[model samples]
Target: MNEPLAERVRPKTLEDYISQHHLVGSKGSLTHQIKKGIIPSLILWGPPGTGKTTLANIIAEESKRPFYVLSAINSGVKDIREVIDKAKQSGGLFTSKNPILFIDEIHRFSKSQQDSLLGAVEKGWVTLIGATTENPSFEVIPALLSRCQVYILNAFDKSDLEALLKRAISKDKWLQSKKIVLKETEALLRLSGGDGRKLLNIFELVINSEASDAVIITDQLVLDKVQKNTVLYDKTGEQHYDIVSAFIKSIRGSDPNAAVYWLARMIEGGEDVKFIARRMLIAASEDIGLANPTALVIANSTFQSVSTIGYPEARIILSQCAIYLATSPKSNASYMAIGKAQQKVKETGDLSVPLPLRNALTKLMKDLGYGKDYQYAHDFTNNFVASEYLPEELSGTSFYVPGNNQRENALKTFLKNRWKEKYDF
Candidate 1:
């Protein structure tokens, strides 16, 4: 008999788990800790199908400790206490090796439910392993979070997904028995959207639909099988990631029409109107920036309007904001500038603040030439003063490069006239 797809592919050990190399890889901190039999309470924060649950199980098995499981969806304070009692019984009050309590969807747990586990975790009655798709800071109570280390799990990359596919095709007894050929993988990857579980499900759907002994899986075959079934937009589910990707790519490609199409898809899928508005707000500052500064204002206003008025009526407001952002002059100069500056800061370590820019509140600081020779721009011609703000090592470093847009062109002209050789196009 063939095993269930989810069970068949469930990673039994950390070595078998895919993705989240930062947490479970050979040299990963968590892997080292688990190998030494010194597991601590930790929160596994990540999107679905990134092996949070599987990793929890592996930790339990490898530790050879008593294991208890609970779901935030069904477990309550009473349930938590019951598990705690069992854990206490398994390992007495002063016992060092306590049972590991694994809670899935722990973000959904209410305050009281989470609080119930805190004492047990603090006292070492159970090593807590909580899995969540939401940010632990936002969802888990501070008291509970304080007792656990939070490990972030990233979405599986293309290579990880491909490795997963290969494993399923070869390792799964059911799949190995069938003659399957992968002609194209574009549609499968598109449909999976970095979700390991979704990828396997789509693979199963394609393989199961084959009529002949020799089955070939291609983009067309995958599309043909799943095309008839409408993929409803799920604001908090897999659809959310897909539509947002489409929306961002459209804006990046400067296709307003495609951008609006994706916007409409999110709205129709029942996405939180405010959530859509927030993404637009970020895109305005990050993607549009000074190219069209007004894009930020429009996006900010749309966010306000959506918060005040929700649903059917707010959709129009969101659509207007999306269209404006999509059609606006696009530049990532400011974004790139900050990113470069941050990278430089990290690479060079901390550098002392230039004397002129330092605070003069203290007498010692003022005596040391702090705030000395500082020229106020307002006192200079054209409200511009040539001065060095960066450290000595980065005195002449240039970061912001103006894009080819009317606003940026005007900025370039102004800077060139003000600083002469200092400003370059």
Candidate 2:
């Protein structure tokens, strides 16, 4: 079978690579390191088709190191060992030019699989290069992550995508023979969603389908071709955003049925259970607030459980959390409180902390009246004391006005009794 356009046109050197100039340009960190022939193990974190793999290849080529590759989806501890053993052989007593081991989709590696790499990476048998679409902090093992520098790769912008298309027409052997005109690219850009590989493939598919040697790439043509080829739900595309929005809104609107339906939609679509749980956790805190504080706890537990369990069983845990959040009493008080507090800070800039509330950890702080007259609420009546806690500029400013609900109402009554109209309860 013929190689795909994405592979055929893959950048073999930094000069051919588009985008990520921050890492590949002159004065770029990686550029300096590569010039010095000293490349560290690193994890490239970014969205799909952002040239993580290409950059890794270029680093190995530029640094003149032996290269090895492994796919986290299929590679296990045994595979890791095999690669390490090969890298050791390739290194051959040369410490300066250690072999470069590139692992695509490194986030998919489980803890044990990741741990197996620690020995080789720590001992410098291979200069590891990992590519991940997910946040490495959450997906990668802490021990392994600490040993590797994490570089962030951004999605291809409009100009970068256009550059890729132009390069393909000018440089590719097959595309060079045909006359292609890009009349419009809104549909292509929107559909590709910043994935360079996907954009090229889509472009190739559209160009190949036309009968004539001349090709006019218009939005309508791109749409017509892509519509028939697009999947119902793409975890990384527009549908992902829309479905997640629907799920959160359903829970906030107190419609358990709608929430569950959307939850099922995500599960069946093979959405990351952790992603689903994370959104529900935000909804619990933002939507359920003081009315049902337990919602946050349950949502947190759901996130932990699903992350640990994964997949089919995780769906059940996510469903339970989603229903609980939908059924719980809804209030945005806590969320509003933070928003209001943030606005106040922006307005006030960096206001000085009230001296009474300041820590007296040092003699200088104590001498400056810090904690000098700070009221000890626990020593006072009802374990409360009216005090000026805010900076002087922010005195009388109430950022956390309780929502009118049973729980917040009780809180209002308690504050009213203790502070005596200070909070205007």
Candidate 3:
């Protein structure tokens, strides 16, 4: 085929599809839906090249439903209407099996554009399958979002990527013609950055560049070939993650200059304003929690502002948030505390709740000692009672370790005074 290898190898069936087992596996949520032809409107949210388009195609095929496609990047309301018209004509509306309308990058649709889809979706003219690399909650309109089930497609793990390569080699007639050996795959996997499509593209590019039919792929060979054709800013691939990593790290490391520099790179490269702002929101909580809770407020405001005012103006809001987060006091106490607590839960599964901690809603529960010995904190002196809240087995376990910052130090003092050495605050 003259088409790119990625397109040529596009999966035609769910068995041919890779990754996302949680959705397509034997016990997956969508498994029954696809098998029974009871497909509903859904929003597939994930990073780039996670096979959102492929999965949509598979759903339509497996469910024996007519499929119509639209690219949100280029399609307008007129285009959406055209597809809906065709879909309604091909199959009756509100029937048990409605035609599927697959829209790629649905996040790019304008408010009016999205609004136009409401009636058709609500009236069951089309089973809308919207794919987005951005968060649907932020990009999709509330009215439309509420009508669709959101399914997340995670980045391809190492094994999934490896299987993709093996499948390409074993299944593709063109690749089978050549004697190809995967000697090393670090460069290929690292460069693709969990994007199955990008990985195939890089693999094909490397194989095609070779003068001989016999190809032995190695890390060095892949790296050298990719470097020649790679762009400095790959918004959807490794560079995307790498640059964002540097941006977040710079802020976490408290280097405002570096943080702003990376932020500028992302903005200049046409990175979505909300994506940048969202990372800052995470950094505010993960890196600057407790030390400066206000950072989250500012980050949230920046996200809201940029979502309303996009492009050139949004860049400034993002930069302002980046610098503020970088300058704020840093702490991961809250982040670590939850992590530790979660680990404890996993270690000690389903510990019984102490009787005093359980609610005494009924007379039977009260007779069973639920809340029988519970002391009301409001009824005690200083509205403080030295009571154990955790499972009795973990009476004095400490999950929170206060960070060495002024705000957290005060928190530590308060905790210490209340617990009186019960926990090593």
Candidate 2: 10-residue stretch with minimal lDDT: 87-96
Q: Which 10 residues in a row give candidate 3 its minimum summed lDDT?
A: 87-96
Go through the candidates in order and give each one's C-alpha lDDT.
0.85, 0.88, 0.92
> Which parts of model 2 have CA positions greater than 4 angstroms off?
25-29, 92-96, 255-257, 307-313, 336-376, 387-399, 421-425
Off by over 4 Å in 3: 334-402, 411-425
Ranking of all predicted structures according to lDDT, beginning with the best and ending with the worst? 3, 2, 1
Question: What would the per-residue lDDT of candidate 3 be over residues 1-425, giving only the tens digit for each residue?
Answer: 57888888889988889999899988888988888889889999998888999999999999888888999989999999888888889874656688999999999999999999999899999999999988898899999999999999999989999999999998899999999999999889988889999999999999999999999999999988889787768888777889999999999999999999999889878888878989999999999999999999999999899989999888888888999999999999999999999999999999999999999899999999999788899998789899989998999999999999999999999989899989999
Candidate 2 lDDT tens digits, 1-425: 28778888888877888998888787676888987779888999988888898898889888899999999989999999999999888862466799999999999999999999998899999889999988898899999999999999988999999999888888888888898999999898888878898899899899888999899999999988778899867787657878999999999999999999998988888999888988998998898899889999999999989989998888888888888999988889889989999998888799988888989999998998988888898999788888998888887778777887889889888888887866766
**Top candidate (TM-score):** 2
The predictions' CA RMSDs to the true structure, in order, are: 4.7, 3.5, 4.3
In terms of lDDT, the best-performing candidate is 3
Q: Mind giving the per-residue lDDT tens digits that candidate 1 earns over 1-425?
A: 46557568788877788877777787787988888768889999888777788889999898888989999999999999999999999873644477999999998788888888888988888999999987788679999998899999898888888888988888888888888888888888878877788788888877778877688888988999988754677564467877898898787677889988998898888886766887888899899999999999999999989988999999889878878888889889999999989999999999999999998998998999999998898997778788988888887677898888889999888877876786455
RMSD versus native structure for model 3? 4.3
Error of 1 at 106 (Å): 4.9
**TM-score-better candidate, 1 vs 2:** 2
